[model samples]
Target: MTTLLIRDGVIDDADQIAGVHVRSWQAAYRGLIDQEVLDGLSIPDRAEGWRRNLSDPLPTIIGILVAERDGEIVGWTSFGSGREEEGAGDGEVYGIYADPAEWSTGVGRALLDAAEQRILDAGHTRAYLWVLDGNERADAFYARQGWVADGASKVEERPGMSLREHRRVKHLAGS
Candidate 1:
């Protein structure tokens, strides 16, 4: 059995987190994302983005929870205050990714649970996230966890192309 633990990411986790983000996006977004957009993804670019997020002072409390197997980081989840104007009552899961080797090993689930708990503890009423429209696997996963789509779609750009993403939300206790 693999023992998994979640911890707050430190400043030094930028590189590791960026690598995980890029690899996971490539794996999870393969067929659903435009090839031209995915082609421009780079670890260095993502690292810089993460660095800025981590440096933000307020409203954007970015935290990276790492899933480790035998002391090796295999997956990560990032959560922060919602970016939308009205939905600030809940934290949003902006990024989630895991190593393909650790997929379905409960890593993603555990990370989400931890993130949601943190959000709730921080007084959030619920949690929400954006998922690309054609990501059936991800949609099913979120549905299984009690998330519901709000029938809203927004255009999102990766690097070279734009795609539509659906907003999904899960109500927390006392929401």
Candidate 2:
């Protein structure tokens, strides 16, 4: 295995990131999410969205990091100020995804670690992220990293149905 490189993402990385996004969701959410919703995902559409996001990124974005191995993007994460209504000291991890093929190879961990550090540097002591309900793998992974659900939940509307998600938070002050 080659060394995994975690670096700041650029606009040129949008296409590859989109590929990772679709594939990761499809694999990670296979049994947890509705199959139809995953099936409806279009790489081109996702790529377009990513292009726009990278091009006109919000000022609050602390940074976006991509984990690459052998010149390919295997994982990525984005973090910044809390998008949701939260206390003043909370940073937020918008999302993190890794190609399922790279699962358990430390790719996601690299991305998470980088995001946490970036979030801390953004002058916030607490960090939070949301995961779809019943995503045991994701929840367990976050737990391993010291994240805990804050009892905050929300329902998200997708194409055909509503999905429930819960917020997990970590205190970065002493870590």
Task: Give me the candidate number with maximum TM-score.
Answer: 2
lDDT (CA) per prediction: 0.81, 0.90
lDDT of 1 by residue, 1-175 (tens): 8678788776677777788888888888898877666777899998897777666634676566887778777788888789878676678897788887777889889888888888778777788899988999889988888889999789976456787899999988853
**RMSD to native for every prediction?**
2.0, 1.2
Clashing pairs in 1: none
For model 2, what is the C-alpha lDDT against the true structure? 0.90
List candidate 1 segments past 4 Å from native: none
Question: What is the lDDT, from 0 to 100, of the residue 33 in candidate 2?
Answer: 79
Per-prediction tally of clashes:
0, 0
Question: Candidate 1: TM-score?
Answer: 0.89
- Which regions of candidate 2 fall more than 4 Å away from where they truly are? none
